[model samples]
Target: MSDAATKSDAAMKPGWTPRSAWAGILSEGSFGAKGPAGVTATAREDLGIASLIAPEDGEAALSQVVKTRFGLDLPTTPRTVVLAGRALVWAGPGQWLLVTENRTGFASDLQALSGLAAIADQSDGRAVLTLSGGKIRTALAKGCMIDLHPSAFPVGSAALTSIAHIGVHLWRADNGPNGAVFEFMVARSMAGSFWSWFSASAAEFGYSVHVGRG
Candidate 1:
């Protein structure tokens, strides 16, 4: 007997369609020991994302345009402002990531503000997932380095950090009946890697998964 096999037989193979890379591995159901669910994960594949870059020394002008257009005061720090189903999330100095369901509408609004800031669609390059429930914070803590304590990363808080070496933008949304709410924004290429770490982290408390229709 030899370890090598003849070419006639193929070893077990793993594959994914160009767009549905994570689909084969994830099922829409609960995993781990069953009990009262401590976490729920939902895909936000339809989300329209874009980067808003303020022109040099045009911060004030950018603020005015965003204010008049979306009735939003651009977040100057790491925070999230939700208005009319859209979130203006601060990414860094004079930069923000806009998340919404209607990308065309959002792009139009950005056009109204483009005179002061640069707008680029980020939808295709980003992967977003909404995570919620009682044990979210604890599960997140397993791989995230930041302090998730309410007093530290309270609701509306957002940050660009890493999980298992994968870069991610983590943010805390309003609390839900189950408990806290949060979302992760990661590069499309690393989504599978990120989820692997997340699923394991969440398994201890029990969790559910929902793949988006998109």
Candidate 2:
């Protein structure tokens, strides 16, 4: 069957409304004219995410498959690696999360690692949030227990932890004056609660809310 036919049939099938998990909480909001001193918050919806579990001692083989196919290396504990169009975050021992802009066939693509790994689609199960700017770490520190100091969680690092009591997969994507962008994935059902906590934490330094594509 053609890809178009598959897509058409999926669309024609009955389903619930495609509203964002953060539809009610995200929008144009700012504390001041310039918004937060040095912080910008963006929410991206419908991103492709998959959970990968590689067999014991198969991390190397799995990494090879990822590197060959996606041009990215499967990161080890507490790290995230980004390629031209995809990113891989270490989720746990022998487990990783794959993120990409295109959700189509993502989970299937990992079949290259077939005998060595297992894949599960989490595209609709979570929401992506990005926090950037000079004071971004400060804002995160308000509600998160993790040490945001550069010496500790440097750029290209990832952590599976909780923020404001909400579980999340967090990672630092960059570092610079206008850099230091951190991307995190939170459960769809907890997006609203996370937003509430984020807002309160960012209030002191002010903040801007951005909706739509990340």
Candidate 3:
């Protein structure tokens, strides 16, 4: 181990191991997995409180809103949903999805808009994390209380579930290679505890932890 690795290991709490490989990736983005070329990974984070509630028109409404507010024309069949600078995917019914970016500027847009929708700022209520690697599914199985096998969950699908007793927004990534990357969104208060639980479960798989911007 390098000097820094040695020191990190020494300072780590019991049952915890420091991961160095992902240090750089975390610092670059909010949540998403870094992987070898052609491999897939899922990443997730909170979309600060810039909530947009559109009506049954679905993508049409979303496109119109994007054009009118941001002058951006959204794609019709976007596998990833982007709103207020945050990207999200559907987690369950009721037109709900998980946002994976910090909602820094979303509040103002929602406030000045009027349409067939509702908007709420939920920036303070959530936290996010990214999971990736060839063994991601195996790693997640350690704590997730769901049948997350590809046949069941499938790519491009998302679900609201629990991990270590905390509610999470779980989404499968579309570009995942070998089906191994995923993103998770959780409540802010549960961040530390969930990390602890996730790290513990990942130990046997040679898991490592990286703390930084991503």
Candidate 4:
């Protein structure tokens, strides 16, 4: 191999770590309207993310593989399910985004389904953020057209929506003591633009940001 290739490989080996998409954009701290913060956005880059796509002819088989491997069924519609610390969020007709915390070999594990479907590593291709607080819904309502009311987009609901013209895969992870905790998955390239819309929307009340280990 060329010297350049060898150096590039070594630089990104073991000790090397990926940087957060929110670096410089989101710092760990409280900001905005001063008083008690009404919203909090946590950058969850520590989470491992991957894309699962089933071939039209292999959808059924792939679902079985997933269930056997992860002990969870893939959602048929826009929804999310957590089983064994992993979240399978429906992305489309035959696609789901798998998310987990502290699972470094996430994508490799998903490879077990490769015989039935395609698995793409999205740990670096996507930016994951968890937004929650008393004003979380209101803040999300500013740009999300879909109704976020519990009666509609209840906990475990997932949707492929747009925020400020940017495409985002959103899911209601859980109902926190204060309110629903929502997670937003967006393309890495659009992270900055999304943050701008998010921060501005939550500024009316107050928001805090906690950067994660990306």
Candidate 5:
């Protein structure tokens, strides 16, 4: 082994070690044996509609509005939920998702409510980047601005925030036994730039870039 490799191995003998193991795993080139190790990009244009009010009033409004607008009954319990629509995914507890679709005209329907709640048309303000691989979260921790531990953010949960200094919405994908994967919705204008930075941060972790279908 080269001097550097020897030293690297020696250092890892104890609890102290470099991130080379993680690096190698990400650099591997096997198909489904291990999916490519890299950051993949996808977009979810989320039209976030949230109803904030006193507990009693909000509860009644949520029940009535959800049934009237989407013909679905709201959950009685207080918890975060997601309602999947043909073009949109409605996240409960006063949250909804017009996922990966535009909501240019959806605002009109919301405006008709007249102070019943607050509606935010965030279609033009967000995009998504889906990062998948066994080492995905480990790679992300190198620069992510939020705590991504499963204990903190379980599956089917999401956080509206930023990574690598760019605004984004992050959620864990439920694509059946795929290990750990994350889908990030970032701003369209920042997509290209964030990709460059995200890829570089992932280099030491062995990233193989690809076009992902969500």
Candidate 6:
């Protein structure tokens, strides 16, 4: 192989281990495991997050651009939709958040598109946590005031809400045999606090904490 190819391969090699914001608090111990029904919350760091802001008059055009680039349309309502390897989450009237697992450099790619959209990388600015199990909704109800009934916030629904006064971008990512799996994206600074609140609220129902990459 050429020297340039060899150097490129070397540069792409994995390096030192990186730590997530929640690394300090997440432990691999059983906290709520004695109950009949239990919840499992996992903290992951492998998700890429990006915020998209479109111009007042550029919503339609930007939506098209997103569709053309990601093979997914921007969700117009408060919902989450996934296509290929990415998810488009409605954040506001004209704004959306882009998320992907194992997809890096997305923010830069989004920014590169010439349009009325403003793209910002939030992969490091936010922490993602996934909650699953039969009692997931019940546990979240302790602090979150949203109606999370299967009929209300059904799978693929996304909402900008608050839990214990901390703002959170929440969505029902999956629902099947394992029950509902809710994903929470919170400010990195509030990750520890959010986890604390979630754990405490889930204690009565019996829960397990799993920490890993997205």
Q: Which candidate number has the best lDDT?
A: 4
Candidate 3, residues 42-104, lDDT tens digits: the string is 223334433455667665766666567665444333234444455545433324443435545
List the candidate 2 regions with Cα displacement exceeding 4 Å. Answer: 1-15, 32-37, 104-108, 212-214
Question: TM-score for all predictions?
Answer: 0.86, 0.84, 0.58, 0.89, 0.55, 0.86
Instruction: Give the alpha-carbon lDDT of every model.
Output: 0.83, 0.80, 0.55, 0.85, 0.53, 0.84
**Candidate 5 runs further than 4 Å off:** 1-39, 43-59, 71-80, 86-115, 175-177, 208-214
**Local accuracy of candidate 6 as per-residue lDDT tens digits, 1-214:** 9999999999999898866868797786678658564788788777888888888889988877777878888888999989877899999998888888755766565665556687787887889988888888889999898899989999999999899999999999877567888888899999889988988888888888877665
lDDT of 2 at 140: 88
Give lDDT tens digits, candidate 1, residues 124-164.
78888889988988899898998988899899999999989
- Lowest summed lDDT over 10 consecutive residues: which window, candidate 4? 102-111
Off by over 4 Å in 3: 1-86, 98-105, 108-115, 176-179, 211-214
Clash pairs detected, candidate 3: 26-214, 40-176, 40-177, 41-181, 42-181, 42-182, 42-183, 48-103, 49-122, 49-123
- Choose the strongest candidate by TM-score: 4
How do these models rank on TM-score, best leading? 4, 6, 1, 2, 3, 5
lDDT of 2 by residue, 52-81 (tens): 998888888888878888888777778988
Ranking by lDDT: 4, 6, 1, 2, 3, 5
**Count of backbone clashes, every candidate in sequence:** 0, 0, 10, 0, 9, 2
Worst 10 contiguous positions by lDDT, candidate 5 = 19-28
Clashing pairs in 5: 42-128, 81-92, 83-90, 91-96, 127-185, 127-186, 128-184, 128-185, 129-184
Candidate 2's TM-score: 0.84
In angstroms, the error of model 4 at 72 is 0.3
